[model samples]
Target: MTVLNGKGVLDGIAIGKIVFYQRKGQEAVKRHVENTEEELRRYQDAKEQEAADLKKLYEKALHEAGEKSAKIFEIHQMILEDIDFCDAITDTIKSERVNAEYAVKKACDTYIQTISAIDDPYLKERAADIRDISQKLIGILTNSESDTFTSEEPVIIAADDLTPSETVQLDKSKILAFITINGSVNSHTAILARSMNIPAVVAVGEELGLKYNGNNAIVDGASGRIYIAPDAETVRLFSERREAKKAEQEQLHSLKGKKSVTMDGKEINIYANIGRPEDVEAVLRNDAEGIGLFRSEFLYLGRETYPTEEEQFQAYRSVAENMQGKQVIIRTLDIGADKQADYFEMPKEANPAMGCRAIRICLTRQDIFKTQLRALYRASAFGNIAIMFPMIISVGEVRAIKQIIHAVQLELSGEGAAYNPETKLGIMVETPAAALISDELAKEVDFFSIGTNDLTQYTLAIDRQNPSLEHFYDAHHKAVLTLIRITAENAHKNGIFVGICGELGADLSLTETFLRMGIDELSVSAPCVLPLRKKVMETRMDR
Candidate 1:
């Protein structure tokens, strides 16, 4: 029996035979083509055929899945027809006098190398898309059949990683779960698996590839472990656990539409943290009261350039309108540290976590800040929209942000644009400095949402992302708890409300403590809303 550990992105249990999926290696031959024009024509013809095939896949996916899942094929089609991609192939053909297949491979490798070198995990995963499209084009040019997986029964798929296109083309009924040697929780494969309610474990390490194919495997997604040919006793234990989990899920689902009020009649708001407009659907499905933290940087990440003000407005407006009057707190760009945008032209700081990021970037680059402010104000007209600034540490930052909002409102008024003049403003109390002076800062904003993730890291003086420091990174440390207590007390004293919108907020063990601390709300991931709500309803606080 073999047990492998990995990071689980979704929760579930699956017992099935292992199915190893290997991408067929495509070798590009450097054969000289006398007719260069003929090679270009072949490239064009291959693109046309690939587009047609993708269109059919898109329609089929749309019928089986929703529009969001089907959008993967649409992105593939766009990539195949991208002018830069086409130019690279033609340029290679003209310069190297090679066959269409070789030129396409060369062009794809250049882009794949470039994208793979990026520091951001989300953008780095996009390299897989380039490779997937390149293989399709090569298959068409060489008259080779595209690879497909056909399973007689449901199986746990094991791969190095899966591209968005590859994931969409999967036979959902035959997929028990997915285990990948290389992938991030933010990868497209993980996102698709979550939407499909499938268990997935990624970054299982290269040692997992050594497991024999077709081995009877049990995947425990909740614990991020996989057992291969487990003992009879282990299997029985996991089977019972799985059944118990199913029961828990049913109970949680029944809690939907129920108010999150404690036994003592203390009301607590349960909200969701979303990164994109599409995530609002999950938020609604989880019956969250509102969106607590909308990471607006998602629109800026994985893109070639900054999103225009109009584009930002449309995205914000969509989330606002769909919420149907529920409050949506959108955090301005929190891009630096672990989340890096190449186009932002940010310098390579040794300690980016404490360096210029978040509100610092917006404050320095008012042009970019003003553009986002303009969009937020414009979208406020749609519904209850609130703006929140992240990584704030002082009264000066809050005042500057208010000034920018004031200027944006004036600009909108001058243009005769409709906007809500009463949009609420808030700030994230992450730093210890912010917590110490919460009373003074609370007077500047409407509410306070403690970002416990950064607060714990900052207070403990540990890098949360460093696995070596995992032992020292304690989210429930007394220092962190004291900071939260102080922040909440000050905010309440200043006639403002306080909530937690971090990973710590979803911790069931700390939920009672937060309630006792007078926390007004808990904003967690959509999946945690029902479970958190259940905890809230069962909680009691003594006066």
Candidate 2:
């Protein structure tokens, strides 16, 4: 028996042994590559093959998407041409590096290092799959048996780690909250779990002989507790806690559309951070005060070309119509590093995080920028809309964006597109430089929405995606808090408001901390709106 600590929502009676789950998608990709090699030769043999044209279109599409994606696409080409990853695996059979397992691990390490250096979380997740495939291939070559046991009865499966694919594949009705011995707060698996509203506990070091056979046990996902053989009394207490929590969730949901004011009569704005059209239903159901941080990346994925202006207009309109008269702060396309949609067909990049991404991509790709800006502008006439630019590093980018807005005004007028001229345009202060110059930037943009996620990452020189550096990526760091203070003071000095649209916005206990920093508004996920509002209603702002 051993003790461990973790955090997740508590659901009762799930007992099973640990099943380490990571990305196992490599075998499929490898199989595709193997099949495509022959297809490549066949295409080359054909006189009318248009590989060059396809490559050119891919290149063009990425160029329009953003700089980080363009760089990523470049690397993707390099991997296909330079890194004979397939050839390397084939040659491993001739001269074993050490043993079959060691060779597989070596291949995995090489591929992991290669992709882990990538900035995109979506692409980086594939690294583990590469290792998984290499392991599978080595086993096949060595004639080693793989885990083929299946369980008929529902059991609480434990794990060392989980990938997005694994979490999604799990039958949620059977599998309870996920527990991982190793995982980050920002991994795609974690994000998917949260998106599904499933209970999950990460970072539990494994040292227990949990039974594979079914046994009555309690799993506290919120508190990160796993009981192999819980006592009747302990199980009963957890049951009560679970019921109370569910009731509390219901109570919070009932507070939707009510108010987010505190006990001390301080009224704080609470809004939803939405991305998809389906989320509009969530916003309407929850009665969110407004839409804050409307991510436009989802539209950028899943196709060969950029989404048309009308398509963007429809998406933005859905959210705007749902909001009715409430204010909606739409953050312009925050693409590039973290959330690269597949439509971009971006090349793999070496240092995509530091490279041109998000608003920096918006700067060069002003044509695409105008399309979104035009859509947002067109939608503005339909509701209370404010524009936010992501990843601002200088006053020059703000001015340049203003010029684009001027250009958009001209185009809109020529095209007879209705829009709100007085709609507030804001900048997301996510860089240390931006925060340091917030006082100056406040004079330009209508307001400042401090994006604490990247702000903390940039300020601490910690890549939020890098688990090795996660120890330093804390939002509670004194340095990051000081920057938040500076940003708020500057915004207030300029008679402009400052809002926070990050995960930190939803942290109920940290409300007072942000209040002390003088943040004016709070933006969180749609479902989190009411709980956050209720927290605000009970919180005293005048600290």
Candidate 3:
């Protein structure tokens, strides 16, 4: 028996025979070609075909894994159509006088190397995207098709690493779980695994490889361990755990439609955070009281240009209408930092986390900000919708945002568009500055939603995206909790509600602390709504 440790990005357990997934393309051999134009034409044709393939994958992913997970394919499509990326392949073909396959391989390798060299882990993971598209293109050029799992029953899949495209292409029904020798929790592949509710462990190293194919394995995602050829006792224990996990999930369904209130009658609103309108289904299925954080930036990502007013309105309206009068708090575009769109043409920042992002971008580019505000207000008539600004630091920023909102309101009225003038306004208390001045800032907005992900990073002066610094990135640091408590206190004093909308909001251990802090709401991922509700109901205050 072998026990291999890794980082588990999802929680679950799987027991099955292990199958090493072999990626489908053959190595592209360097070959000289006489007609450069012909080679370039081949590359273009293959690129277009790959783009179409990605579109299909996008549609499939949308149906299977919601919009957030499906957006990876759209990003891949954008990457495929990127002018710089296309020019690289074409330039290599013309300058090197090489076959299309060889030119593509070289161009992809160069780009991958360049991206991998970046100190930023998020950008570093993007190298896998380039490699994914290149592999598909080369396979098309070489008349090779990607492989699919053909096992009669579900089996655990092991791979060195999986690209977003490759991960989506997998047959979910045939996969019991998947383990990768190399990956990150922030990687798109890991995100997909979590969205699909599949057990996944990453960064397991190369020791568990092809040699162990067909071996019985137990993947304990909660423990980040893979037991290869597990002994009888280990298998028995895992089987019991798996059954208990399944029963627990089934039991959570009973919590649906129940109010997220404490036994001591301290009621708190439990909301869900979403990326797009299509995610509303999950929000509703989980029976969240409302949406505390609607990440509006996703609508701008994976595209070549800004989403127009009508496009933005339709999306916001869809979610608002679907919620059926449930409160939906939409955070304005929080672009920059880890979440980036090349079309924005944002300048490179030495430290983008503290750089121009969220409210900063909207303020600098009022045209963009106003367009979104108009859409949000117009959509407000459909159902309950509120606008929240992120990464705010001062009272001046809030005043400026309100002024812009006033202008949007006047314009909508003049244009005879039906909109709710009573729409609530809120700010994300994500920075220390905002927390310190929560008293003054609370007077400017209708509510405060603490974005603890950035709060913790900024407070600790740590990069949350860096896996190496996971030990130092303490979400429960006294400073962070104090900030939250301060923000909550100031917000309540100023007659405004405060809630958490970051990853920390879902931490069950902090539920009691938050309840004790007089937190009015807790918004987390859809899957967390019920569990959190259960915890809230079972919780008793030590008064």
Q: What is the C-alpha lDDT of each candidate?
A: 0.87, 0.67, 0.89
User: TM-score: which candidate is best?
Assistant: 3
What TM-score would each prediction reach against the true structure? 0.73, 0.75, 0.89
* Candidate 3, run of 10 with poorest lDDT: 59-68
Better of 1 and 2 by lDDT: 1
Q: Write model 2 residue lDDT over 161-262, tens digit each, in one string.
A: 764334544555555556777765566556556655666676666542344234455666656766756676776777788788879888887786576677
Q: Candidate 1's residue-wise lDDT over 1-543, tens digit each?
A: 899999897889998888998766666788998899999999999998888887777665544444445556756765786789999999989988999999999888899888778665545656767787888889889887666899999999999888766777888899999999998776666767876779999999887874568899899888899999888998999889889988999999999999999989999999998877887888999999999999898677555699999999999999999999999999999988766666898987999999999999999999999999999999999999999999999999999988888888899999999999988899999999999999899999999999998999999999875544556678889999999999999999999889999889999999989998999989998888999999988888864
Ranking by TM-score: 3, 2, 1
Clashes per model (N, Cα, C within 3 A): 0, 14, 0
Q: What is the C-alpha lDDT profile of model 3 across 114-208, one tens digit per residue?
A: 87777867677668888888889999999897876678899999999888777888888999998999998888899899988899999999887
Model 1 spans with C-alpha error above 4 angstroms: 1-11, 28-147, 159-173, 179-197, 200-241
lDDT of 2: 0.67
184 in model 2: Cα distance from truth in Å? 7.6
**Candidate 3 lDDT for residue 338:** 70
Against the true structure, candidate 1 reaches a TM-score of 0.73
